[model samples]
Target: MRRREHESLTAGPVCPSTRSPRYTCRKLECVFSLGHPSIARLLTIKLGSGHAACIRFNRSGDLLASGRLDGTIVIFDIETNGVARKLRGHTRQDWKCVLWDLQDGSRLRTIRFTAPVFIAELHPNTHLKFVAALFDDQPILVDATEELVVKRNFQSAPKRSQLDMDEATEKILAQDAKQTTTVTTFSPSGDYIIAGTNKGWLNIIETASCQTMFSTHMAGGVITLLRFAPGGRQIVVNSSDRIIRTVHFPDLTGKNVDFGNFRLENDHKYQDIVNRLLWNHVAFSATAEYLVASIHMNHHVYVWETAHNSLNTILEGPTEELSAVEWHPYKPFLAAVGIDSGEVHLWSVIAPQKWSALAPDFAEVEENEEYIEREDEFDVVASEELTKRILRQEDEDIDVLTIDPVKGYGDHQEGGFKMPVLLHQDDEDSEDEIEAIGAGQYRRKSPGRGRDRNTANEATHQNGRR
Candidate 1:
């Protein structure tokens, strides 16, 4: 039998005849490795009650407020991962809106209406104030600090001229009456409040006066969702017709508009299923450059470029039906989505890479090498002289004409037409002229022929007749 080599932990594999002991070499094993990780799921909290109907994060991002179909609102502390407060007293008919203290997971107040509350939004400027839309009544502004309705404006339905109408018209009118306000939001400046109805009517009301400034029908179906983009200059409206339109606020001219007509790629099989679900979801990015919308029952989120009204990307991670989606306030790439499976997911725009480098340091350097090199190459003296020369040239090109006060026209010569330059008179002179005119003592020049010329013409006509 052939002799086998003996291996030892700390001994050489060769025999002792060798000058130096040759130990068996092993690859180094690392305990820790450094690399850039791609965007992925961070943390998920299961509510046990299935899907949450609505979720909103406070301004400080310390607390998350979620409302469920069981008419309960749970406020969760992000850091501690505990339920800070639980609020009750709402019905499960529709989605409920809640307001909470951003710093602490404390329930500020809850506003309940007689009908189903379809939409609620906190005032952009006021912390403890918000607005809610009701099914049977008008939208109301509630002050959480005082726990009362500060402003309520009910929109009156259009009246018919004659009480006697056809049966078809009356049925149509009855259907219209059943429609409710579905969405409500405030302008960025908090100057105006916009509300949408199920019947496709959009009303823009001035918050200060509580009066409707403009009202128009946007589309035929319900207005599912409406959001005022950053800067509050434009608003995006999503209707049940699957048409997304961005309109200029305070104008509503519908001109120079950006529209996204969503059509499923291969939706022939899922058309009926998707039509049954209600899609009232829309989210705007931090910079308002991108918009993410949840397609009802489609298990897909469409990321759109607001400027071009085209698809930027398609997110297809949700396995079940989607409930809602919200974008991170500060991070443009990060977004949170809620699905019917009782799981909330976080997504980012970063792609996975094999050979990754540390995220480029955003820290500012006092003196950058490239900046210093460019500075040395720049001709500062020449630039300064050129700037001064351009300024001087602009000043020279400016024509500064002095306007002189009007002077009275020279005495009328012969029959030449002359215009008198009226001068501004003193107060006393104005008063005197007014009194003289009132007393019928001021004779105004007649624009027609003079009195002497008229008398001479009349005398010449009489002589000719004789």
Candidate 2:
């Protein structure tokens, strides 16, 4: 991760008070709410219930899939604004998670576990494969394309003492005790499947071999989340104990560099924790230069630059606690979902070349101000400072943003674009200007920087060198 300078953002409109409704004045080209609204656009679809567990979007952004507590997966078509399909596979069963492939819509997969699923995810490049963490059973990697068959299962058993085994424990054991795997994710390259369990055990299985390449211990308790770095060089795991550890693995082919390291940055520590955390998510930027993670309990998200392990920006909001976070696939925007209100917040860490894309009315408002000045032909600037200050108070918790120039991710060949960073936190300033996560002030290269030496000296080099 590249180092980012922490600066205050004062350019944004002051957030409205929470007591009032947000209203936009089209003529004035300004927006004011009963309270300050941080979201630019929000579309709320009535779920069967108000509760939503997870949300996923297809590659084309045409379909939106959400899993609810009712064990049903809801699919909606954004273009038609209608229900595409309602999957009932997990409705009656004890399944913990459901995932829809962005590449194809013909298939939907669900994970059945003895325990509830904390979180699940699909590979960015594949459709048939998906992984889910089971609180009671092993994290199962299911091939949803093949009739939802289980391709590989990773079970982590908790260590038990012989003296602690009673008759009831033996009876429970005889009935087939279930194991628990708390977190799982695919490597950035999609070559490895990583999972963590309650025993502080971390396992990385090669997708092809289905064998453990790296399995190690933490102090104890379940690992809440596993995140692969953008460069795929380091794996960070969080546990029920207040600790976020970075583990480094050698080449999986039994090389000389197989080792691991961990660091605990949280202040408060719990003793003998039983239940794993529910909200655990990790995201990397487009350039794989930074990792953004939510600090448990505090309800604050910390941005960690990968270059020197420095904290970039600390993002906080009022009322709604963050449930999920995702970095833009091709841009520098970070999308965070609120758990309390089913609201999604988008934050742009970098500034786009054209800033008009953020608030559509900024340009129109500017134009109207210019026209009014021309009509009046007065040298006076509207000093509505006191009135404006009385109407909209400054937000002490929020700041204006400063964008650093970075190389934006390339567009997707299939139509859409993946922010070169899988985890997108940067926002695009405008449609034309793309936001890059960690792009710096490196000079742009010209087209003719590299010459075709072989084509120019085919005969001359062949005769001389041969």
Candidate 3:
């Protein structure tokens, strides 16, 4: 058996330089100056030994769980600014999940797998359980109370005698077989566990039955992160192919088909950059309205709006590369960003308004006299004409007529055809009408014109009406 060496670091108050334009720090408070407004860092706890890989705050915000690369899990009491318990296991591999006693951090449970664990997520409804993705293996659900694997997808290999195969052949076969689980997360309802593999496949398993509900390939590259939105109706995925996408999960109660069950709603492509650091970190806001992701090897974070499928904001990080980011569960306005410099920054979306020198004086009579007069004039006009203007009709009657040149002239009389009456006075007075009819705005009289002309005019008017 190998013994493990453990080390723990305590929190201390450190004030950063106020003159620096990028970061502003005071006692227990650090404000990051993004272009528009500043975000304040509420608390900072420095871990002395290994690089911090992941951090999670309990529901009460009194306890914080931080995991490191050296397989050391430390539980910090935020109220006291001290370490409550430090557990050591799975040397050299990253600590995937750490469950601590929120009341006093007395009871601690750490889960270690045969291969390194890439992702771990606590159940939203319960604190004593979590789901973890193991390297080259299926995901496992850990029971914190019993400290046992309640559910897992492990398959036992067939046993063989020594004569069946040589040791060298078995070693070569084992080396050739490679599988990896890159990321895993629990759904908001705690009924399903979502896991992603290196082959760009995602699997959703039922927690009660431990059966796979849906599994399908998502992208070409490895999947980096799988996060369920606050409502659990949708999930956001980040992959090594530089694509961030959102998938929706509808009611999957009676659906029998396996493949193509998940539907993609939106996606965003990130800029290409050459760096070895893992840029797959993604998080959703408390309200699930906005999503934040770290850029690969870049000192910037992208904030996206799920509704618009557009970039909403860019949060600037430190000069060093960003490692991870977590949003406050209860505080929708606060966010914690972790950088490579071993510093965890606290940022707030809400900023204080700074008073300007040209602010208006609301108390002075002269300053508001013009506004008051305009308001009075607007009120008088609105009351007097608003109703009338709303009720007034602007429609005009349009007359559509199809006239035939031959039938435009009335029925023929004994002398000549009776000319049609012009609706407009200008047309009646025109020289063209006089030359065509040999009369100005009048019909020529003939011997039998009285009754015949009247009957013919009445028939023509009736035909025009039809």
Which candidate number has the best lDDT?
3
* Local distance difference test, each candidate: 0.51, 0.48, 0.52
- Residue 35 in model 3: lDDT: 32
What value does the lDDT take at residue 331 in candidate 3?
49
Q: What is the model-wide C-alpha lDDT for candidate 2?
A: 0.48
Tens-place lDDT digits, model 3, residues 1-466: 1111111121111111101111111112445333333444454443332334456654434445565434455555544544555544435434344454433323266555555555566665566566666655656777655645465562112223345446548564463244456677766666776767666767667777676656566766778777777676778887877677787766444435343435444454443345534454778776787777776456666677777776666666455555466665544433333443444554554445545435754343435444445545645575558667755643544456743333422332123222222223121111112111321122234546477879999999999999
Two-way TM-score contest, 1 vs 3, winner:
3
Cα error of candidate 1 at position 126, Å: 2.1
- Model 3, TM vs. native: 0.55
lDDT of 1 at 104: 35
| Candidate that would win on TM-score | 3
* Candidate 3 global CA lDDT score: 0.52
Least lDDT summed over 10 consecutive residues: which range in candidate 3? 11-20
**Candidates ranked by lDDT, best first?**
3, 1, 2
lDDT tens per residue, model 2, 161-264:
34445434665554324545667788765667777766676666666656665555663566766765555666666675655666664334333324333222
Root-mean-square deviation of every model: 37.4, 23.6, 37.1
Error of 2 at 388 (Å): 54
